[model samples]
Target chain A: MARQQRGIRTRRTILEAAGAVFDEHGYAATTIAMVLERAEVTKGALYFHFPSKESLARAVLAERPPLETVPVRPCKLQEMVDVTFVLACRLLDDPLLKGGVRLAVDQCAPQSVDHAGLFRRWADHLTWLLRQAREQGELLPSVDPRETVEMLVGSLAGIQLMSRALTERADLAHRVAVMWSHVLPSIAVPGLLPRIDAASDRGSRVTEDLG
Target chain B: MARQQRGIRTRRTILEAAGAVFDEHGYAATTIAMVLERAEVTKGALYFHFPSKESLARAVLAERPPLETVPVRPCKLQEMVDVTFVLACRLLDDPLLKGGVRLAVDQCAPQSVDHAGLFRRWADHLTWLLRQAREQGELLPSVDPRETVEMLVGSLAGIQLMSRALTERADLAHRVAVMWSHVLPSIAVPGLLPRIDAASDRGSRVTEDLG
Candidate 1:
């Protein structure tokens, strides 16, 4: 039992170090030597733990605990969108996720092995959340929950990347949420959209310059 | 005059070669030596043309010709959307823009230069188109043209990245146009929406899977 716990700790340390190095230097520029230096682990120990550099990166990319395990409230679709945006902000706000987000964006090449799986998983998570909203009758029946999820997730990630590059603002998560709410009504079932119409109207004037 | 034209030709060759190298190897991985090799120019010619590696990269990144220099007609809001999407497809489809688009997405820590200028120009172009649409009473008076433009450009770019990463289909341009037509109505002036309502309704079911 003790041996297993030690192995887990060592693996976590290497993954964290890899995320930082990859974020700073990009995937191609990052080297195994840098990983060893950052983790402060000996060469033998690093290899014993992660067989290769790619393996180490895959671990870093997949390190987050499953979203299913994350505590979620049974909020309606609009509230869920609001909450999900908040959580996305909270995740990016974390120093750990910042490096990973940077690394993911940096390595998102067509040829890179990382792009397909990471984006698909992200889409899947969004779809799952939207599916829940649909079952609760929050999303419009005319809207396909899966497709809506894709657009929402894809737009949010793109905006996040652009905002981070442009502003270096840590408050990007909040900004993303604000932008998202405006388009949210269009996807909600017609009757439900009016429920939040008052709140949306108040802030509609504030984001006139976002482009 | 002949010598100046020759110099211009050489510069074009180098710039095109640099874009190709950056596309294949990404920004960090690409080097001037590779650009020189691809352009088949001597080191002296390369240096004389571009003072440094970063300078060459800046040239490659700078000044994409405007996709739409003039409207074909008066540019109705729906036609503007269609024309602009067609232009986007052509740019993204081109070998030159393909790599640039990848760079735009994967580039994490931009050089502390005026890189935001690129996106700013894109936003400007989109905003101009939307303003024309609004003047024609196609878009809602309540719509903030700037934010709407950002969402449109950002969403299209995001969708392209996702499509490139997942499907490898060269037809993403066509796909996005179909998708955007659905999104257009949601932001159009309330009564103007029904103008395209019939067309959008037909598409709603067609694009259900991937919209």
Candidate 2:
């Protein structure tokens, strides 16, 4: 049991080091040796987990922000906001997901990397949440869940990209907070606006609640 | 004078070829040899023009969509929509600007690429147009030009990225047309919405009119 647990921890450490290196040097420039140096693991151990740099990058790309950690909400609108907040907060420090997002948008990635899968899966998740919001009478009448998904997904992506370029995503949570202020007025029920918590710090609060 | 014109044309051809190569292979993977193969130019000539791959990429990043081709409009709101359509239309075929957009979003680029400059310049342009719209009484009383610029710039970028990932940007003009439909309602004066020329093909029409 201890051996298995140690193996799991080693795997996570390698992934973390890969994310940090990818974030700093990009997927093409990052080397296995760099990851090994940061991770302080033997190359044989590294190869035991990931066979190639491409596989390592693909694995990092798959490490999406932890969306499932949030407790389910009755108000689905609040649930959606919490999802955004939590992801933004996580992005501030979690090199894995942050680097994943960078790699997803990176046009330099090899043809084999499944960049579109991330965006599509995110759309699927957001689509489900928005649908629930609409069913509960929380969404505006003109709101099409698909259209909302496109706008929300695209805008959030752009906002984060811009934030990263401008501030190294230092103010991502705040920019996302600003995005919600613009978007909610157009989509959410006016009466419920006051109750929704789209605050920049909602992510930390939710994490604290979970912790 | 004829020799000067020919030199200018060769420079343009070289830039075009570089953009196409960069679009396909990305900055890190692209080689001057591949550009020479695509450009059918002598190595001496290519070297005389762009000294390095980094310089070539930077030049492409600087080759923004030709916003000046658009005629100034009486309604800055129409101008803004036209700008979006023109860019969307051009993105369908212009390898240079499309490649520039790709490079700008690519996180794998080396540190000297200056990706943020493109976004910042675009914002400056949009801010000027939106300020004009507000001055001409075409903007909503509640709309802040800076806020609108941030939303428009980021959302347009995101929409284009998503459209590219999904359809190779075949539907970008149409998607941008849809974007204006969503955004204009929240910012434009209600009376001016009817007059805005935000159709999907407005880009082609405006281009043909100029031609």
Candidate 3:
């Protein structure tokens, strides 16, 4: 069991190092040697966990930092907002999430990995939360959960991309808050609108609470 | 004059070929040789026009499709929607615009070129129209023109990107329409809301009228 734990730690170290390199240099420019150097691990040790750069990228892409860090609230709409806020916060500070998003959006990423899958999974998660919101009468009767999920996912992607390009993502949480402020009024029922918080600092607060 | 015109035509041809290649293969995978082959121009001719692949990518990035295809309407809000609709339509069919977007989003594009400039330009244009909308009392007094422009550009980019990744851009116009439907209700005053037409076919109509 101790040996297994050590292996797990070593694998995680390599993944984090690889993600950092990929985030800074992008997929095309990244090399396994860079990962090994960053990880400060022997080539054989790195190869044991990730055989190739593609696999390392795939591993990085697969690593989704937990969104459940935020405690669940009675209002699913607020919970959904919390998820995005927390994600924005993590994306700003976490190399793994940053690298994953960069790789997922990168057109030069390995062809075998389905970058769209990440977006689809996010949509699915949001769809489930939205359905919960609908059942609780938090959402407007006119709202279609699927379409809203797509818009949320897509718009968030765009907001993050723009923030990254323009501000190096320093203002991602603010941009996301602004996005939700515009979108939520159209989707949420009037009764629930006032109750949900879409503040820019919501992400940092959640992270603070988690810490 | 004739010699200058031929030079202009040759440069245009090289740019088109380069744009198509960039759109299909992305920045890292593309090569001058592939562009030469696609354009069926001699290496010397291609080199004379665009000295390097970076220059070719830059030339492609510099090409902006005219968004003035839609006639300016009495309602600046409607005109803004028309701009997006027309762009959505153009992005669906125009390789140059598509490639430009791809390259601009591409992190690997030459660092010297400003990728955010495109978004900034769009925001600037939208800000001007939004200012007009504000002056004409088309927008709610609470609406911030700059924030609105950033959201519009970012969300449209997200919508288009989602459409491209998921549906290969088949539903971009519809997605744009949906985005506007959600966004316009929040920014436009109650009186002006009914005047704005956010329809999937609005793009094609604008294109036909322009033609």
Candidate 4:
């Protein structure tokens, strides 16, 4: 049991090291040797875990959706907003998630990497939450959950890409707050706005509960 | 004079071929040899026009903002809408523009490529039109132009990226139309949407006028 725990710990170390290197240099420029150096692991150990650069990248990009792990909220609409805010907050500190995001949007990745599939998964997650919002009477009658999904998912991707350029994602939560401020009027039912926390610092506030 | 004309045409051909390859293989995977084969130009001719791969990519991405050559419209907001439509339309047919956009979003591009700068230029262009829209009273009183710019520019990029994944951009103009359907009510003054052509075919109609 102790040996198994050490193996798992070593695996986590290698994954984190790979994420940092991929984030700094992107996928095409990254190599297994660099990850080995970053992890300070024996070549045998690194090879035992991630045999190829492609596998390493795939592992990094395969983070489970935050909604699956985070506690469910009373309000589905607020939950959707929280999901984005949580991601925005995490993006600032979590190199692993940030690297996955960069890979998801990366055009320069090899043809075998299904970055498009990542976007599809995100749509599915948001779509499920949005349907719940509609059933709860949290959303406006005019909102089509699928359309809302595309706009919300894609716009968030764009906003993060833009924020990364403008502020290295330091202000991502604030930008998301700004987006929610504008978007809620169109998607949320009237009088629901007052209950929603679209504040820039909402991420920090919500994440504290998770810990 | 004939020799100079031929030189110009050759330069255009090389650029087109490079754009197609870059769009197909992305910036990192593309090779100058592939471009030369696609262009059917001698090594000497290719070298004369472009000194390096970096210059070739910069040229492809450096399409002058279309607003410079396209006719100005009577309504600034409509003009802004048309800009996005025209781009969506062009992206389907113009490999060069498509390649440039792919590069602009490409994380695997070399550090020197300045993909971030492309997003900045987009913000500047949108900012110019949005201020005009506000001055013309086309925008709502509550709208902040800069904030609106970030949302519009980033959302459009996200929409395009999603459309590419979903349908290879075949449905991009329609997606943009749907986005406008949702967004216009929030940003535009009451009674203005009736005048703006946010239809999916707006791209074809607007570009026909340009041609």
Q: What i-RMS does each candidate reach, in Å?
A: 2.8, 1.8, 1.2, 1.6
**Taking the tens digit of each residue's C-alpha lDDT, what string does model 3 give over A1-211?**
9999999999999999988898887888889989989999889889999988889988988886566567888999998999999999888768888888888777788677676767777788789889999999898877899988887788888889899888889998889988987888999989878889999999889879888
Residue pairs in collision within model 1: none
Model number with the top DockQ: 3
Q: How do the residues A35-62 of candidate 4 rate in per-residue lDDT, one tens digit apiece?
A: 9999999999999988899888888877
Q: Write the per-residue lDDT of candidate 4 for residues B1-211, one digit (tens) a residue.
A: 9999999999999998998998887888889999999999999999999999988888887866565544588888888888889889888978788888888877667657776666678778888999999988899987898888888887888788878876889989988897887788788887887888899999899889878
lDDT of 3: 0.85
How does each model score on TM-score? 0.82, 0.94, 0.97, 0.94
Each candidate's DockQ score against the native complex? 0.38, 0.57, 0.74, 0.63
lDDT of 1 by residue, A68-179 (tens): 4333546456444543444454444353455555555554333433744655676687677778878878776567767666666666666766666656645455445455
Model 3 achieves a DockQ score of 0.74
Q: Which residue pairs come into collision in candidate 2?
A: none
lDDT of 4 at A14: 92
Worst-scoring 10-residue span by lDDT in model 4 chain B:
B62-71
Minimum summed lDDT over a 10-residue window in model 1 chain B is located at: B200-209
**Angstrom error at residue B156, model 2:** 2.0
Summarize candidate 2's per-residue lDDT along A164-211 as a digit string, tens digits: 888888888887887776678778888998899998888889989989
* DockQ pick, better of 2 and 3: 3
Q: How does candidate 3 fare on TM-score?
A: 0.97
Q: How far does residue A8 in candidate 4 sit from its true spot (Å)?
A: 1.5
